[model samples]
Target: MSIERIISRQYEIANGISNDIGLPKFKKYAMCNLRGGIGKTTLAFNLSYLTNDLLAVDTCPQGNLSYFFDNQYYSSQAPTVRDLILPYLVPGLGKATRVASYVGATNEYFADKNVYYIPSTEELYLLPSQLITAINQALGLQGAQKEQSLKSILYSLKEEIDREMEQNQLERCLIDTSPFFAGATQLAWYAADALVIPVRTDQQSVKSLELLINTLTSPQSEFRKYLPTNDLKVPQIQMVVLTHCGWSTVSGARNEPNQQTKVYLKKVFDILSRHRTLLSTGDPSNHLFMLDDFLGSGRISSVESKPLSLLHSGETKVIDRVRVSVNKSVDKCKHQLQYINQQLWG
Candidate 1:
């Protein structure tokens, strides 16, 4: 079947589901994909503008998202996500700290917006091994019980974040997950109400999507296998963003995705069709959004730690000793983000 036809059919299915059962309102969104360099962090940072009172969580050990929000976090002795999860890892330590105590406001760029973030630390790299050791040493818990205990430890952060949100009146929580589905990323899945997966226009990303879906749905997969025995729930796939899509010029005007992009998009749509139950039901238009490859604009925004909405066209910045100019791309990028935000929360 043609890609367009498949998308139409999927849309019909989604619309029917929406009409029958109603859509879920998601307050916590996890930006995730099994592949890296697909603009997951960028989407998380930009989407913070979706709400005025926002709490962004950096679950990646690399701390890229944390740095973007506040570079000083790396140099200073600030509390991080590591601090929040440390108590659970060490038995002698006191209970987990309040999430609000660890959260810090964003830098000057986001000063106008009430944005707070749980910074990341390089020490999070050691979490997986430490978590496993902690889980195995728990007394009287075996097999599924042990797994449930591990899940509870990982999920504790989410519970605290929920309380923090209630106490502080935060409107939304956005979790920036690591590419690997281990440690903190697992915690992100447990915490999120929904997921926004960003896929690059490439074969590797397609395979990564398949792997991610398997981890979420396949009966024999690591995470899914535990679901039947435990009360664990995986977040639904709320949106699949096709990032870095290329546009070709036709008769001196650029419109629609390029041929290569279309081909991969078909592959993606095909994968999603087989797992319709995993998708969130709502307006079909909200299920997918194509984002252009605004390479220069993206670099500038990341380097400056600003959202596309705050960036202007025709701006030039020196990146790596090269003067890169931002053309009209920023406008389109900003518009796409706004549309996505509206679909998600408007």
Candidate 2:
């Protein structure tokens, strides 16, 4: 009866991750999207290092994660852990992608770290052409199928990663994606275990998230048709991290808005809630929470930063004569993640 109902749609996603679980569930990627300086890199880098308990791949053109991992800030001045990623990096590639040079990292054992990091280099700027040459060199396979060539290249990379993981029986993967959503972003999403977006609650940034969801859901998108079904579901977006935010006159600004800024941001976040739910992702109750006032809370390490790290949750303390709510929001995130992981594992 409506124009929306006039079209047909279908998606045939593969099942079965190569795990001992014996079912089709394997989490291979953890990609994120948000602009530069939105703490996207921080969330990705720290979470990867923490969760995987090993090296993390920083796959971006700017090489943020990659550089951080290699620099003295992270460890001794060793040949970057990225060297381990060399085997994964291609040789004399097709389509000429500006792939990260595995040039320095020639160690076989270093790549053996539970986590294998693939840093984004300026070479990524030339990746499109590199891919083609890779295939051509493999056996001189080329033709009009050229358009669909990327799919094969991507699948090959995934296979290699999976092979390495299976051979080593590693824990999981943590992949940091590029800033934008197409090109490299597409590759990372297809390989992701889960996604976590860092949301900065300025009016403009909020608008971008709105636009992203709308664009992804729009009819023109390849994934759009599957929106109403489970097939088009986005990989698990574990949580939305809101940063660079300050309380905007909770009591003085027009009746304090009757709702907290964190709460309103939650509504904006829901634009992708369905995708998270479909993938059986999210901790629901606490998955929707706010970062404590950074200034009010004073500098402290994330409790999750260390296993068994404990802190008082839901405590109300007075700061600078202002009875600001601290620890409550953060506690909510911890609790939410705890419950969600339990449910998922069970």
What lDDT would each prediction earn against the true structure? 0.74, 0.43
Provide the TM-score for each candidate, comma-separated: 0.87, 0.55
What 10-residue stretch in candidate 2 is worst by lDDT?
6-15
Best by lDDT: 1
How many clashes show up per model? 0, 26
Model 1 scores worst on lDDT over the 10 consecutive residues at 12-21
Candidate 2 clashes: the total is 26
- For model 2, the superposed segments whose C-alpha errors exceed 4 Å read 1-26, 53-55, 72-116, 128-150, 214-219, 222-234, 245-260, 273-287, 293-346
lDDT of 2 by residue, 27-143 (tens): 554446546656666555434433432325555667666654444223333332233333333644333222322312532223333444545555555554554355455434345
In candidate 2, position 165 carries an lDDT of: 54
Model 1 clash count equals 0
